[model samples]
Every structure is written in C-alpha cells, then in structure tokens.
Target chain A: MKLTILGCYSATPRTLNNTTSQVLEINNHMFLIDCGEGTQVQLRKHKIKFNRIKHIFISHLHGDHFFGLVGLISTFRLLTREADLHIYGPKGIKEVVTLQMKLADSWTNYKLIFHELTSENSELIFEDDLVEVHTIPLNHRVYTNGFLFKEKEGDRKLDINAVEAANINIAYYTKLKQGFNVKNNDGVLIDNKKVTTPANKPKSYAFCSDTMYKEDIVPIIKNVDVLYHESTFLEKHAHLGPKTKHSTAKEAAKIARLANTGTLLLGHYSTRYDGLKAFKEEAQEVFNNVELSEDGKTFEFN
Target chain B: MKLTILGCYSATPRTLNNTTSQVLEINNHMFLIDCGEGTQVQLRKHKIKFNRIKHIFISHLHGDHFFGLVGLISTFRLLTREADLHIYGPKGIKEVVTLQMKLADSWTNYKLIFHELTSENSELIFEDDLVEVHTIPLNHRVYTNGFLFKEKEGDRKLDINAVEAANINIAYYTKLKQGFNVKNNDGVLIDNKKVTTPANKPKSYAFCSDTMYKEDIVPIIKNVDVLYHESTFLEKHAHLGPKTKHSTAKEAAKIARLANTGTLLLGHYSTRYDGLKAFKEEAQEVFNNVELSEDGKTFEFN
Candidate 1:
C-alpha cells in the first residue's frame, strides 16, 4: 500500500503549503480523502492520474476539507470521464455539490453517486472481496467521520512440489488453496496444510483528522498498520485544541500510544507553527514510531 | 493603472497553468475579478496583500470563474479580517455561497455583502471618488458580464510656480484646482487656466472573458486604455468558438480593432495550444497593439 500526502496544512492554503487532502492506494483502489481547495493542482503536481480516483471521502463540511470537490467534479466532466465516481461524505455534501452543478448548468455525463453519511456510531461503509472500509465516528465541532481501510485476508498459497508429492488432482488443488482437506485420486484424505501454506498477513490503514482527543476512537483504530491523525497544535497551544475541537501533537501521540498503531503519521498542521520538527518531537515523547506528513510526501507500507 | 493576471487558462487549472482570475488595480482600489480555484494561493505567490482586496467581481457561475470564492472568504474569516467584503456576481451567487457557510456553520465575523446581478443590460455596479465600475453584458452559455474599470477625472494639477508668480491667495488654490475662476487677494478675477492645467487623461480598463464574438460590448468598452478579452482558440478552431460560447484570437483582435482599445490583452487560452506566441501573432494580425496574458504577468497602463 502507498499513501501520498497531497496537502497537510490546516484552515488555509499557502504558496508553499496546502490544506487537508491525501491519496491512498490499496488493492488497486485510489481513494481521495478530504479534498481541500487546490487538490486537483496538487494531484497534477504529484503526477497522480486524475482518472484513477474512483472514490472520494470527505470528513466534514469545512471549506478547508471539501471545497475543491465541486471543481474536481467539473474537471472530470470537462475531461469527458466516463467512469462512475462515488463520493462518501456528510449528509449535506450532496446538496452542496449538486447545487453548484445546477447553477453552472453542467452535469456529468457519467454516473455521480453520493453516499451521504449521518451516523454517529462506527459502522461498515464499503466492502469488496479484497478490502473493507468502516467509518470511525469522531468528535468535532461538526458531524465528522474518519475512515479505516483494511485488506481482507487472502487465500492460502499452494506449494506445487508438495501438492504433486501428495498426488492431489487438479480439482483438489482449488480445495487445498481454500485450506480444506480433500480426498486424492487413490481415495486417501490429504491434509491441506501439508500441501499449502498460509498467505501473508493483511495490512490496514486508518485516517483520522479534524477531530478532538477522543478515547473512543482508540478502540476502533486499535492495532492498525498505519494511523494518520491530525495534530493541529503543539503543547504550548494545547488549550486551543479543546476549544476548536482539534488535537495537539501530544494528544494525537497519546491516542497513537493507546491504539498501538504500527506508525503514527501526523498531519493537518496549523500554519502558525514555523516548523514540523516540534510536532514529531512532541509525538515521539509518547509514541516511539512517528512520522511527519508534508505536502507531496509519500509513504509506502509492505 | 496596473492589471495583474493571476490565472489565464480556460476550462481547468493545471499544475503550472491556472484558470480565469485577475487583479485590476485602478486608483487606490484593488479589484479582484473572476476568482478561480487556487486563486488564494496564487494571490499569496504573487505577494498581493489580501486586505487590499475589498471587492471581488465574478464573471459568472462557472466553476473556473468562481469556485475559489468560498475558500477565499473562509480564509478571510480565519485570518480574522474585520474589513467588509463585497461580492458582485450572478443572481444565484448569494444562495450558493451562503448555503456552504450555513452547512459548515462557519459564518464570517466580518460583514460579507453580496451584490447579485440579474440584468442583461450594461449597468453601473460600483463607484467611488476616483474609480467607477460598469458591467459590460456579454453573450455566453450562461448569464455573464465583463467589467469596465475607469479612473474618474481628477482635480487639475496646479502649476505651483505659475500660481506663486500670479500671487494667488492660498484660499483660492482649491477653487483654481477645481477649474473655477476665483478672485485674487487684490480683488482681481484670475483665470483658472492661467494657474492650473487639466489633469492627466483618465485611464480605463475593460475586462471581457468567456464570451463569444459579440460586438454589443464594443460600445460599452470603446477606446479603453486596456482591454482583456478571452481568446480560447486560434483561427484554425474558429468554428468551435461560437459553438462553445468562446472566442478565437482573431475574433478578440477584431473586437479590439472595432472598439479602438489602446492595448489588447488576450487571455483564457485553451490548454490544447502549445504556446502563447501563436495567440499573440494571431491577434496582432488584426490589431496593432496586442499582448498575450500569462499567469503571473502584469500590465501597467500609463
């Protein structure tokens, strides 16, 4: 899995920095998260294929989180994209986007499906044969949700030499891969473990942003391979976190420590801070594995 | 008068190219016209002061023209701007903008005044002591209007040496500057022309964009100091101009010639073209003074 940080700043977009937006590639799916203003330009700058974005997930209705959505949709129409696009966001997202399109008198030739989310509890939102996505209800000033993408466990790998030694027929090979004991041609029952080995462990990623320090989410995102949490403030400005319903670096680190995530990625930084080193330092004091997210940066997980 | 091109491309913004937007500075007011997406970042990249932009004029409801408006307004609120902001656009602009703010529950602390335009005829929209703005209704797929910014004629410049030589009383200086004959200290009627000369000729700039080859606006923007007209295509694709409600470089130059504009500035070029030199060459064929507008390019009119 590969994740690209299209933008990581908060509130406003600057010349050198952008607001909240990211692209995650998992199991052949490119999911766009929180498309802030100027996200299309950032995608182009990062050389990401625009047509590859099939699903878009918006955390909330903030301008910094989803202002770029309508423009990106119009661009898709301009490019004559025929692929059906799915958008998962707050309940008001559909009205906001369709109104703009109605005013412009420009409608997409392709199917534009909207999955409006209004639930206050964690629930499964999307699932396929290879992956599953669930909503992680977050505490914020507005109705917001973080997403957790997890890869489903795969079928067992077949050992060709062991299968041949066991005299397993081609029809029984499928059963062996499914970890089922099957009868061979000689009417002898063969154990599936002798002919096949277990597949590699699946990986999971959780994205959380624009939220306050809520301990409830820690249980939901526990033991994820990677966790991207918003750290909009430092320890000095920790008081503003609760007031704004945002998280400080230390608070995000505490959540990371509680969840026991493999990696804690910090992003959505407030522009008031001069550098990102302080956030990493503060997060590292509590969580040993921490990384900082910047615009145009990419991270890969095996 | 100075006009800065914040974005010049049409349809969509690219990694290096931007969409339709410009900053026209006349007298002491800085007028922002057609705020496309990424305009705030472009404003910062060009080092334009945000507070100086008190008024924003959107050409139409198209995404390329006004998608960045909400984000810009939100940024102003985030910056805690106290100045009142005036937005002039189509009739549906207020509803579109206010709905987003209402959904996000992020209303601006500063006053946000909307001047929605529904008229198809040319009309005066803004006026001050030194500058006056009028709308030049253009023919397009949607209701659209181009803006004409004219510097009001200033007070006559008093020839200090000539006034001193005439022994004119300081009290009568204001009357002389107002081009009125006033009595001197010796009770002699002094001619105003003898003490003061006429002020520099008023400079005007007309912005026309996203329109077809319509000549109705020629009378409204006639003989302006500078004229920025959209040239979305070249002569080879001239047939597509009218169909798309756009204009070719030759058509823009023809309008420039017919209106007798001082300098013809061509912008809003389609991304299909390779370079801007072809547009300049094509426009120069019909008009003597023609220049292509590029992102970050600025034009100063004397």
Candidate 2:
C-alpha cells in the first residue's frame, strides 16, 4: 500500500500550505480521506489521476475537512467522468451535496452514492474479499469517525517443487494452497507445512484527524502498519483540554505508543506554529518511528 | 468603485486557474460578488482583509459561482468573527447554507442574515445613503439576477469659492451639498453648482454573469462605469444559443455595446479554449473598451 499526503495544515489553506486530505492506494484501489478545499488542484499538482479516485471518506462536516467535496463532484461532472463515485461521510452530507446539484440544475451522469455514518461503535463500513474498512469512533467537536483500513490475510502459497517431490496430484494443489495436507492418487500422506508457504502478509492503515487524545482508539487502531493522526497543538497549549478536541504532538505520539503502531505520520498542524521540528522532537520522546506529513508527500507500506 | 478578481476562470479549478469569485469595493464597503471554491484561499492570496467582507451577493446558484459560500461562512465563524454577515441570493440559498451549518454544528457566532430573491423585476436589495444595490434580471438555467451597484447621486458639490462669492450662509452649505440652491443672510441666491463641485460623481459598477445575451438588462446597466459579463465561449461556439443559457465573448460585447458601458470585462472561460486572447479579439469586434480578467487582478474605477 502507498499513502500520499495531499494536504495537512489546520484550519485555513495558505499559499504554501493546505488543509487535511490524503490518498491511500491499497490492493489496486484508491481511497481519498478528508477532501479539504483545493484538493483537486493538489491532486493535479501531484500528478494523481483524478479518475482513479473512487472512494472518498470524510471524517467530519467541518469546512476544512470536507468543504471541497461539492467542488470535486462538480469538477468530475464537468470532466464528464463516467465512473461511479462512492462517498462515506457523516449524515447530512447527501442533503448538502444534492441541494447544490438541484440549484445548479446539473446532476452527475454517473452513479453517486453516499454512505452516511451515524454509528458510535466500530463497525464495518465497507468490505470486499481483500480489504475491510471499519470506523474508529473519535472525540471531536462534531460527529466524527476515523477509518481503519485492513487487508485480509492472503491464502497460503503452494510450493510446487515440494508438492511434486511429495508426489501430490495436480488436483490437490488447491488443498495445499489452503494449508491442508493432501492425499495423492497413490494414497500417500503429505504434510501441509512441507508443501505450502505463507501467502502475502496483511497490512493495515488508520486515519484520524481533528480529534482529541483518546485512549479508546488505541484498541481499534492497534498494531496498524501506518497511522495518520492529527496534532493540532503543541505542549505549550496543553492547558487546552481534550474537550477543545485538539491534540498536541506529544499526545499523538502517546496514542501511537499505546497502539504500538509501526509508523506514525503527524499532521493537521495549527498555522500559528511555523517550524515542524518541534513536533518531531516532541513526538520522538514517546514514539521512535514518527514522521511529519507534507503536502504531496507519499509513503510506501508493506 | 474598485473590482478585484479573486478568481475568473470557469468550468472547474485547475492547478493554475480557478472558478468565479470577485470582490467589489463600493462606497467604502467590501462586497463579495460570488463565492466559488477556494475563494478564501484566493482572498488570502490577494492579501484581502477577510473581516472587511460584510455582504455577499450571488448572481446565481451555479456550483462554480456559489459553491464556496458555505466554506467562507464557516471560516468566518472559525475566526470568531462578530460582525453580522448579510447574504443575498436566489431562493433556497438560506436553506442550503443553514443546512450545512446545522450538520456541522458550527453555526456562526455573528448574525447571518439571508435575503432570498424571488422577484422577476428589479428590486433594491441593499440601500444606504451613499450606495444602492439593485437586481438586473438575467436569463439563465435557473432563476438568476445580475447586480447593479450604483453610488447614489452624491449631494451636489459645494463649489467653495462660488459659494463664498455668492455670499451663501454656512447653514446653506449642507443644502448646497445636497445640490439645492439656498439663500444667504444677505438674501443672495447661491446656485447649487456654484457652491459645490460634484459629490464625488457617484460611480456605478454592474456585475452580470452566467447569463445569455438578453437585451432586457441593457436599461438596468446602461452607462455603468464597469460591467463584468460572463463569456463562456468565443464566437466559434456561438451556435449554442440561449438554450444553453450562456454567451460567447462576442455576445457579451454586444450586450456591453448595447448598454453603452464605459468598459467591458469578460471572463468565465471554458477550459476547452486554451488561449484567452481569442475572447478579447472576439469581444473587441463589438465593443471598443474591453478588458480581460484573470485571477488576482484588480481594476480601479476612478
């Protein structure tokens, strides 16, 4: 899986910075997270194919988080896109979007589906044979939820040479891939582990933004290969409670440490702070594998 | 009167171009013409003081023209703006804007007043002592109206030297400024023109966009100092008649010429045509004083 950061600033979009947005490419599927304003322009600047974006997941209804959704949809229509677009967001997204379309008198020719989320528990929002998406309830100013994308464990790979040496029949190859000992035509016993190897390993990514430091999300995002979390404040503003619904760099690292995540990507920085080196220094005190998220930056995950 | 082009392109925002939105400075008040996507960012890029924007006038509800209204409104709330915001647009604008605010649970702290336009004829939308705003009925896919911002005829200028020469009393100064002749203590008749020059020669600016060439608007915007007309295409695509509810550059110029506007500013270009010079060339054929608008460009009418 490859992750690209389209924007990571907090609140406003400046000339040199942007708001929250990211792209996750997993199992040949593209998913957009938190499409802030000017995301399309950032996508174009990063050379990301606009048509490849299929699934859009919004964290909340905040202007900075999802205001660009309408423009992106309209742009898709203007470009005459025929591919169906699926948006998973909080409730009321459809009404706002459809109302704009009704006023403009221009509706999309392709299928436009909105999956509104009002659930408070971690539930499967989307699932295919290869990938599953679950919501990670977060504490924020509004009804917000983070997403956990996990890849299913792959089937066991068959060792053709070992199977042949064991005299396993061709028809028994399927059983071997399923990690089952197979009986050949000669009625000989075959060990499953001797003739089979492990298949591709599963990977998981978690996305969280505009949320306070909450311990509950640790269980939901535990052991994630990568975690993209918001760090809106610094330790100097620790007096601002989690009720403010904003986390500092140290708080984000604490969550990553508790979750035992492989890597932590921090963003959603308040514009007040100019340098990001402080964030790294603060986060490194708790989590060793921490990195800053930059616009148009991409990451590779195994 | 001053007009600032925050964004002038049409169709969709690209990495290098943006949709429709402009800032009109009239009678010392900042009025937002349209709120396209990325308008706040454009406002920032132009170094415009966001708080100065007190009123917003939307010509129509096309996504390209008004999609950014919600974001701009939300941004004001986030910035803790206390000034009341007044919005005037077609029917349903209030519903759409308030709906988003309700969903996000982030309504503005300041008063947000909505004035829905339902009239088919011209009506005064806003009026102060110095400025008056009227609707210039337009023909489009939806109920639309262009805006006419006219500086109310100023109080007659008191030609100071002429007033003294006429022995005009100081009490008659206010009357002379109002363009009225008043008697002095000496019973001398002071001509209004003799007392004052012109009260700044009330300037007028008309903004018409996303409409076909309709002769009906000529009388409403006649002799306006500056007229911004939407030109989505060049003469080559003029075959798409008023049915499409759009005008070519030449068609826009024809309306400007018919209205006898001081200068014609053409914009809202279709992305299909890469070169913008064609629009100027096509418009110059009909109107002698034609200007091309681009993002971040400003026009000062003096």
Candidate 3:
C-alpha cells in the first residue's frame, strides 16, 4: 500500500502549507480522505489522476476538513466524468452538498451516491474479497469518524515441486490453495499443509484526525501496519489542545504505543508553530517508531 | 484605481492557471469580485491584507465564479475578523452560504450582510461620497450582472496662487472647493472659476464576464475608463460561444468599440489554447487600445 499526503497542515491553507487531504492506494483502490479547501489544486499540482478516485471519506463537517468537496464535484461535472462517485461522511454532508448543486442548477451527469454515516460504534462500512473498512468513532467538537482499512488474508501459495512430487493433479490445485485435503491422481488422500504454504501476512492502516486524547480507541487500531494520527499541538502549546478538542504530539504517540502500531505517522499540524521538528522529537519520547507527514510526501508499506 | 487579477481563466482551475476572481481597489475601498476555488490561497500568495476587504461582488452562481466564497468567510472567522462583511449576489446566494455555515456549525462573529439582487434592469446598488456602483444586466445561461464602478467627482483643486491673488479668505476655502462664489476679506464677490479649476475627471471601470455576444449592455458601460470582459474563446472557436454563453476575443472588442471604452481588457480565456498572444491580437483588431488580463498582473488607471 502507498499513501500520498496532498496536504498536512491544520486550520488555514497557506501558499507553502496545505490543509488535510491524502490519497491512499491499496489493493487497486484509491481512496481520498478529508478534502480541505484547495485540495483539487493540490491534486493537480501533484499530478494525481482525478478519475482514479472512486471513493471519498470525510472525517467531519468542519470547513477545513471538507470545504473543497463542492468544487471538486462541480469540476467533475465540467470535465464530463461518467463514473459514479461515492462519498462517505457525517449525516449533514448530503444536505450541504445537494443544496449547493440545487442553487447552481448544474447537476452531475454521473451518479452521485452518498453514504451518510451516523453510527457511533465501530462497524464495517465497506468490505470486499480483498479488503475491509471499519469506522473508528472519535471524540471531537462535532460528529466525527476515522476509517480503518485492512487487507483480508489471502489464499495459500502452492509449492509446485512438492505438489508434483505428491502426484497432485492440476485440477486439485484450487482445492489445495483453499487449504482442503484432496485425493491425488493415485487415489490417495493428501494433507493440505504438505503441498502448500500460508500466504504473507495482511497489512492494515488506520487514519485518525482532529480528535482529543481518547484512550478507548487503542483497541480498535491495535497492531496496524501504519497509523496516522493528528497532532495539532506540541508540548509548548499542549494546554490549548483540550479546549479545541485536538490532540498533542505526546498524546498521539501514547495512543500509538498502546496500539502497538508498526509505524506512527504524525500530521495535521497547527500553522502557529514555526517548524515540525518539535513534534517529531516529542512523539519519539513516547513511541519508538515515529514518522512526520508533510505535504507532497509519500510513504510505502510492504 | 488599481485592479489585481487573482484569476482569469474560464472553467476549472488548473495547476498553474486559476478560475475567476479579482481585486478592485478604487478610492480607498477594496472590493473582491468572483471568488473561484483556491482564491483564499491566492489572496495569501499575493500578500493582500484580508481585513481590508469589506465588500464582495459575485457575478452569478456558477462554481467557477463563487465557489471559494464560503471558504474565505470561514477563514475570516478563523482570523477573528470583527469587521462587517457585505455580499452582493443573486437571490439564492444567502440560502446557499448560510446552509454550509449551518452544517459546519461555524458562524462568523462579525456581521454578515447580504444584498440579494433579483432585478433585470441596470440599477444603482451601492453609492457613497467617493464611489458609486451599478449593475449592468447581462444575458447568460443564468441570471447574471456586470458591475460598473465609477469614482464620484472630487472637490475642485484650488489654484493656491490664484486664490491668494483674488484675496479670498481662508475661512471660505471649503466653499471655494465646493465651486461656490465666496466674498473675499475686502467683501468683494469673487468668481469660482477664477480661483479654482475643476477636479480631475472621475474615473470609471466596468467588469463584464461569462456573457454571450449581447450588445444591449453597451449603453450601460459606455465611456468607462477601463472595461474587463470575458473572452473565453478565439475566432477559431467562435461557433461554440453562443451555445456556452461565452464570448470570443473579437466579439468582446466589437462591444468595446461600440461603447467607446478607453481601454478594453480581455480575460477569462479558455484552457484549450497555450499562450495569450491570440487573444490580444484578435481583440486589437477591433479596438485600438486593448490590454490582456493575466493572473497576478495589475492594471492601474489614473
């Protein structure tokens, strides 16, 4: 899986720093997360293909989180996009987006499907043969949710030399990959594990932003390959985190440490701070593995 | 008068080119016109003082014209702006803007005044001692209007030497500036023209965009010092102009010629062409004094 950070700064979008937006490419799916203002321009600047995005996930109704949504929809209409677009967001997202379309009188030619999410518990939002997505309820000033994307376990891999030595027919290969015992060409029962080996371990990623310090979320994102958490403040301004319902660098690292994530990625920095060095240093004090997310940066997990 | 072109492209914003938005500074007032997406960032890139803008004029409800308005408003609230902001646009603008604010649960601490216009005739919408603004109704796919900004006549410049030679009292300077005949210290009636000359001719500017080749608006914007009109296509693609409710460069210059404008400014070029050379050459064919409006270019009129 590869993740590209289109924007990572918090609050206002500046010339050098952008707001929250990321593109996650996993299992042939490109998912857009938390499109802030100027996200479309950032996407163009980064040379991301607009048509590849089929699903968009929004965290909340904050202006900094989803203000670019209407513009992107309209641009899609202008470009005459024919594919269906799915949007997953808070309950009020549909009303806000549809109202703008109604006023402009420029309805999209393509199908626009809205999945309004209102559940406060962790539940499966999307699932397919290869991947599953679940919602992680977050504590913020508004109704918000973080998404957890996990790759499903794959079928076992066949050892060709071992299968041939066992006189297993090609027709039984499918059954063997499914971990089932089957009769070989010699009419003898064969064990599934003797001819096949288990597939590689699946990888998972969790994205959380604009939330306060909540210890209950550690279980939902436990043992993920990568975890991206918002750290809107550093230790110097840690006092301002609770009032704004935002988390500090130390708080995000504490959650990552409890969850045992392989890598902890920090983002959504407030513009008041001059540099991002303090955040990484502060987060490293709590978690052993830490990474800082910047605009136009990319991370790959194998 | 100074006009800064923040963005002047026709449709969707690109990596380098932007959509429609401009800043007009006349007689100490900063007016924002047609805020497209990414306008807030453009404003920051240009280093414009955000607090100086008190009024915003939107041409219509098209996404390319006004999609960035809600984001700018939210930014103002984030900056804790206490000044009143006045917005003038179509009848449905209030509902569209307020709905987004309601969903986000973010209201401005400053007063937001909306002047919803539904008139089809040219009418005076704003007036003060220094400047007067009028609407020039234009023909388009949607209800639209072009703005006309005219600087009001200023106080007459006193010929200081001539006033002293005429023996006019200093107490009567205000009357003399108002073009009134005042008695001198010797109680002699003095002629107004002998002591003071007329103020510099009041300058005017008209902005017309996203309209077809309609000649009816020529009378409303006639004799303006500067005229900025949309030229979305060239003569090669003039056939597509009427269907899209856009105009060609040659067609815009024809209106400038008929209206006797001082300088015809061409903008809102479609992204199909590479350079702006064709637009300027085509517009210059019909009008002697023509200027091309480019992004980040400023035009000053004295």
TM-score of the first chain alone, every candidate = 0.97, 0.96, 0.97
Query: Quality of candidate 2's docking, in CAPRI categories?
Result: medium
Q: How much DockQ does model 3 earn?
A: 0.79
lDDT string, candidate 2, B148-225, tens digits: 999987666666777777876687677777777788878766556655777677888888888888999999999999
TM-score for the second chain in candidate 3?
Answer: 0.98
Best by DockQ: 1
Error of 3 at B81 (Å): 0.2
lDDT of 1 by residue, B1-302 (tens): 99899999999999999999999988889999999999999999999999999999999999999999999999999999999999999999999999999989999999999999999999999998999999999999999999999999999999999888888889888888889988877888888899899998999999998899999999999999899999999999999987999999999999999999999999999999899899999998899899889999998888
DockQ of each model against the real complex? Answer: 0.93, 0.73, 0.79
Which is the better candidate, 2 or 3, if ranked by TM-score?
3
Q: Evaluate model 3: give its TM-score.
A: 0.98
For model 3, the stretches where C-alpha displacement exceeds 4 angstroms are: none
What is the per-residue lDDT of model 2 for residues A171-226, given as tens digits with 9 covering 90 to 100? 87887887888787689887899888998889999998889999999999999999
**Clash count of each predicted structure:** 0, 7, 0
Ranking of models by lDDT: 1, 3, 2
Better-scoring candidate (lDDT), 1 or 2: 1
| lDDT for model 1 | 0.93
Model 2: per-residue Cα lDDT at residue A128: 91
